[model samples]
Target: MTLSEQIPSDARIAVVTGASSGIGEATARQLATQGYHVVVGARRVDRLEKLASEIGGTALQLDVTDEDSVAAFTAVVPRVSVLINNAGGAKGLAPVIDADLDDWRWMWETNVLGTLRVTKALLPKLIESGDALVVTITSVAAFEAYDNGSGYTSAKHAQAVLHRTLRGELLGQPVRLTEIAPGAVETEFSLVRFDGDESKADAVYRGITPLVAKDIAEVVGFVASRPSHVNLDQIIIKPRDQAGPGRFSRK
Candidate 1:
């Protein structure tokens, strides 16, 4: 279905974070195409400007980990119908015993704390919209803990539970919370996780066709377009080659 057709008349303004690239980028474009007034945010001002121009959406400089930045970012939107929290990532894949404290903190700050910062800042706007939606891009790691992914796993799992707790808090409110968990998707995710190691990132999907960013973006569109009474609480999507967390069948 088309965006205009999918969007409820009461909810048309959609805000997407981490929109410089990957699933965030794709979702921003998709929402705009679907007729929502899309507001895209990220640290890369130039890239966001380009994307905003391309999609006819507003672009803002936002650092989810920074309170001041998030405050400034949300302050501009008079009203919002959807908030996509895609501004999280993994740092390194070190085992628990070999983990670096700093790495763990960065992961927690970016994944868990970052989501909290943005949500807290924007919840008021969303609640004001009458029938708003909040969707987050989590990971398959949220459910399965792997050997070398202690920090990332913990952060994701924390975020997953965080949303569940939020649902209870907003029970009577007209806000819907959705979490989109993806498995083995090919994007800058691995590059960032491995600290810009090109070969290591490429090796991640060498044998298997992974889910691209647009795949998740499409899901976001569907969730955003649904009726006000329907809440798609969580969607766990993975490539056919991926069985579970760290379980991939490469060709």
Candidate 2:
């Protein structure tokens, strides 16, 4: 059967981008448990299929940085009541003067434009569903900047602004927008940032306990389960040991 046909006509559909791992994966699982038919998307088809199998959801190959991929992925989604904009990352920790243009490009493309493309494509569906929620997984970087983190922080700021802008633009619309900004989450995030340097990645959480993927996922679930009239605008989550960016309370 076709993908759109597979989803029940009355099902409350939730589309999760970057669902292969970390926060995205956990959020997809959480939404599935809440009885939403979670349509999981990511660049990794194998992992997406495996996750879909476990959660009884649909898997679609997606690369948010690619316009064609976003178009094709959105084309098959029959309906969307929830959209988790979780496909984003950081690359390199270089100062502005020593920055790699390629890394900056990647951060902007993935974190900023990526969110824009997917959100814009599915907005009509979200609005048409009549009680839609858009949860964007931005970072604490969205709020503050630190040394050697300009590229990521800047992109996050832009992404957060983009999300916030919709709040006013979509005012009176059925769609609700929530931005979840997390701090010190231990996942593949650091590994990717450090370019497979396990030691560097490991050091990021050495002195303090960090937030895990499930923590953010549960919050998404909570927001999703809220009554349609309720709109939880913004949530900033951090491990107890973290005070802010680079202000970790180390043991």
Candidate 3:
């Protein structure tokens, strides 16, 4: 049967990490619109509260890097049929030679280990739900690397591989795993990468109609709304003006 048919009218539980802004915020809102009781988790409780109130979902203060936060967040969310792993980002853009080891460590800790922590803590609840779905938001850097992209790229690669392994391991289970790799999405990602340099972030998408948070959100919704038998393993989304990593057209 179709996904809509499979999802009952009664509240279906959905847990979305990094739901304070960008794609995470959009996903939480979209899921709630789809009749799911979404639990939005992030470090920014104020933003999360605003979003939750607007979307009619619950907001929980969760820092994915903290074990206690992960455990507490999952504990509060009684049931979760869908898990969106979207809490990850990089801080620096430097070549390996000049790159700071601390930056790399931070990226891996948050992008890779953080995801693992949240997933593992919530897996039992997901499995018990019998129709669980896990959607991980990775990046194009996972497959293609450019100068100064090592730290972020490596972390994304780890996340992608984790999803791949999970997909294989959960073959027969009711849960399904998916990885989405988005390229050049115009969001706070670049701003965070550039340390709040608005101009630099804007330059990244200057001449191109890059993907927006809503774009990724729509894709997440589509994947989640598919039939239970159909699993979209990996999706690579990019703006038409951008060919691949570090290749964007200037008009």
The prediction achieving the highest lDDT against the true structure is 2
| Clash pairs for candidate 1 | 3-34
List the candidates ranked by TM-score, beginning with the highest.
2, 3, 1
Tell me the TM-score of model 2. Answer: 0.99
1-251 per-residue lDDT for model 3 (tens digits)? 53234445467889899999999999998898888888889999999999988987788899998898888788767778999999999888898889889888888988899999999988888888889999999999989888889999989999888878998788888998889999988878989999999998888898788998999999999999998889999999999998888898978
Each candidate structure's count of clashing pairs: 1, 0, 0
Residues 11-116, model 1: lDDT tens digits: 4788999999999999999999899888899999999999988988788899988889989888877678899999889988888889999988888888898899
lDDT of 3 at 228: 87
Per-model TM-score, in order, reads 0.95, 0.99, 0.95
Error of 1 at 194 (Å): 0.8
Find the candidate with the highest TM-score and give its number.
Answer: 2
Q: Please, what are the lDDT tens digits per residue for candidate 2 over residues 42-64? A: 99999999999999999999999
**Pairs that clash in candidate 3:** none
Candidate 2 Cα deviation (angstroms), residue 164 = 0.1
| Cα displacement (Å) at residue 223, model 2 | 0.3
Kindly report the root-mean-square deviation of model 3 from the true structure over all alpha carbons: 4.5
Count: clashes, candidate 3? 0
